[model samples]
Target: MANVKFDHITVRYGSHTVLQDFSLDVESGKIVCLVGPSGCGKTTLVRALLGLNKPETGVITVGERCLFDAKKHVNVPAEKRNIGIVFQDYAVWPHMTVLENVSYPLKKQRRPKEEIRERVMHALEQVHMTEYARHLPNQLSGGQQQRVAIARALVVDSDVLVMDEPITNLDAKLREEMLLEIRMIQKRLNATILYITHDQQSALQLCDKMAIMQQDGTLCQYGTDEEIILHPANRFTFEFIGVSNFIPLRQAGSGLALDCGELIPYTGEVPPQAENGGFDLGVRPNDIVFDPASPLKARVDSRVFLGSEYNYFLSLGQKQIRVQQSMLDARTRGVAKEGETVGISFLNTRFYPTQKGEQTP
Candidate 1:
């Protein structure tokens, strides 16, 4: 398997710049997810990788082959790049049967019919779509059609697989099933996959490495799932990747004070980019506990009893926050009713710069 590299890539349309000086590397045989808000250039970057959207500057390489380089004036055609892409819409032709769809690429390359049949069937087996090889696209379910799409992409035997919102069309349960199936197939083939999605949960669960892009077309942060989750680089990262509470802060002696007048002891590693010697306290809902002795108080506004836990929406002053508690805890200590008061304490927290959009102090 070959690694994909983007070096100082930039793309623009007329006066609007889509990506600026973006550089990232997807390691060989690794799953990397590119996630961000809508219109953050994730799709544009993918298109550039596939040679569909040519960058105005910089270079792109898959494995050892340089596909695009502004200095060298080299731009390879998309078809010649040998990159397989599974699009969000499945892109399956309505008139074609599964076997025909899977073998279309090979047929276009003038691959021998016997070899095409062997590879197409093997690809179908990988996606568990062998039984539906003769079925037309309209005859299959959404998930089955998606499997056929995957089979088509795999039949090319590309080292790098690019998936663009491959599961958005499926129901929640079906999405989960496809996620697992895709992960398994990827591992079995050891294909380096670059998956793009607006779904943070799927990105977190599926990718070994995660990259977050901002609305301004800049890569905000990129690292392993654990690194990004536990140590977000900025306020945007904290708020975007997962559910987070942003508590306003004030200077308090050597440490910072919360809006609710709770003293947070100073730590050496204050987050970069906070203003006025202030930082925003960042904590996940699950880390916010119900502490009777805690000074912070909030009114429960709503409660959602998920199968394994209860998510409580609480109002602290005018700001709202969510807290999750295990069902076992709820049974042992009855959950606070809506409109009831509860004490709040943070089990863990991260500090972000008080100012939004600032990457560093």
Candidate 2:
């Protein structure tokens, strides 16, 4: 296994910069996911690591070997990098049988026929595609073709695996199944994985570490799933990773007052360095509770049935807040009828200073 490192990397096109001074490290044998919105340079990072794009500055290293260094003028070819990559499109050879596709990498090494066949069959079995080994990619379902692609990547025995939105094309159930399969394979192989996706749910479920990027290619935040969820660095990090309700607030005396005619006790001290200006309160949908006894009240604006739970959109004065409750709570407590009034309480509240329409640290 290899630890991948990006040191002060920058990429530019013409005069416009894409990624600027980006640095991150992927620890060996750990799955790290890079997630962000479209045009955020997630793909650009992957391309640079894969030797498809060259950075205008800085260095990239895998383990102790320097892969790219602008100062040293060293550039390693993709084929010599010894890394396995699985694309979102399931880049399988349509004309090749499943077994043949899995064995393609082995053929490049001039391995003996018996050993190659053994490795190919083992890889197919690992991905549960042994039954379809004789079938071509055209004959298999999307999920099966993806499994073949995984098998091909695994059969090479590479130390690091890079997957680029591999499950985006699958149906919900199939996507879940593939996620489990990929996790199992990674565990079994102890492979260091760098997965790139825009889906926060997938990143939460699959990666041990995650980094969020911006449109300008700067990294907004990088940490474990829990850290990113509970302690978002800014508004963009909060909104990008999950659903959050932002309520306007202002400083009043020693405490903060909601702009909407309500005042909740502030448990933490707002930073003294924070500009004496507008602020916003952030709470996730799951962090808001429906309490009938609470003084703060809201009218039910809409409701959505979400299988095991119900999501309610409530109007608190002019502000809208979303609350999630168990299906049983919805049924027993009686669903919040449209225009019906209900009390609201914050389960976990946080305050941030807003500067020029952006949340500041």
Candidate 3:
């Protein structure tokens, strides 16, 4: 396994610069997910590292090899880079059996038949797909097909494996199973993986560290899920990582008030920076609790029971915010009807400094 480096990388198309001065270091033998929205240059970065796209300025290195260096005028071919990529669609051939698919890379290199068989079976075993070696791609489940795609990437024993939205086609249940499967495979091989996706939930479950990118191709924050979620670097990181509710705040006499159509007195402690004015109070859905004795009132617009939790949409004055309650909490406290007016209070909230006159969304 190798540590992948993207040092001061920038990629452009025609006159437009899609990626600008992006730098990230994927530690050796660890899974790092590059998560962001669509058109955020996530795949562009991957392509540049894979030698498929030339970076305008930067250095790309894996292990001891320098695959690309813009100043040195060095550009390795895609095949010689020794980096494996599992695409969004898996890209397995329907006409080929699992063993044939896994062995194709070696066959292209014209490796010894005996060597191909050994490596192919070993890769299949790593993904727990050895039993279905003879099965065609069409005969396998979506998860099983993904395993074949991963096994093919492993046959060459690349230093880094790139999974780009690899399980987006799977159903919710299958997606969870595949995430666990990918984690197990990574552990068994101690593989250096760069998983790219727009899905934060999956990234939270699979990454050793996560790199968040903004829509304008800027790297927002890079850290463990806990670090990013609990201590967000900025408002973008806070809103992007989880379910967030933002309420506009303004100065009301000696204290603060929520600008939710009506001026509701904020009994919560105000952070020092937000004391002067114009800040958005960002709260996670789970942090908002119902309080019968509280003056902060909101009308419940809808209630949904999601097996393990309850999701409620509440309208506060003219603003709407989401609230989630665990099954135990719902049963202990009580559930709210669609038209019921309830008092809600925030627990852990973050203050986001905004432009002085910025209106609420």
Best by TM-score: 3
1 or 2, which is superior by TM-score? 1
| Candidate 1 Cα RMSD after full superposition onto the native fold (Å) | 3.7
- True lDDT of residue 304, candidate 1: 93
Query: Which residue pairs clash in candidate 1?
Result: 272-361, 273-360, 273-361, 274-353
Ranking by TM-score: 3, 1, 2
Task: For each candidate, give its TM-score against the true structure.
Answer: 0.90, 0.88, 0.94
What C-alpha lDDT does candidate 1 achieve relative to the native structure? 0.87
lDDT of 1 by residue, 49-147 (tens): 999988999999999999999999999999999888999965799899999999999999999999999999999999999899889989998889998
Error of 3 at 101 (Å): 1.2
Question: What lDDT tens digits, residue by residue, belong to model 3 across residues 1-361?
Answer: 9999998998999998998888999999999999999999999999998888999998989988999999999899998989888997658999999999999999998999999999999999999999999999999998999999999999998999999999999999999999999999999989999999999999999999999999999999999999999999989889999999988888889888899888788878877888866888999999999989889999999999898999999999888999999988898889888999998888898898865567754
List residue ranges in candidate 3 displaced over 4 A: 252-255, 331-334, 355-361
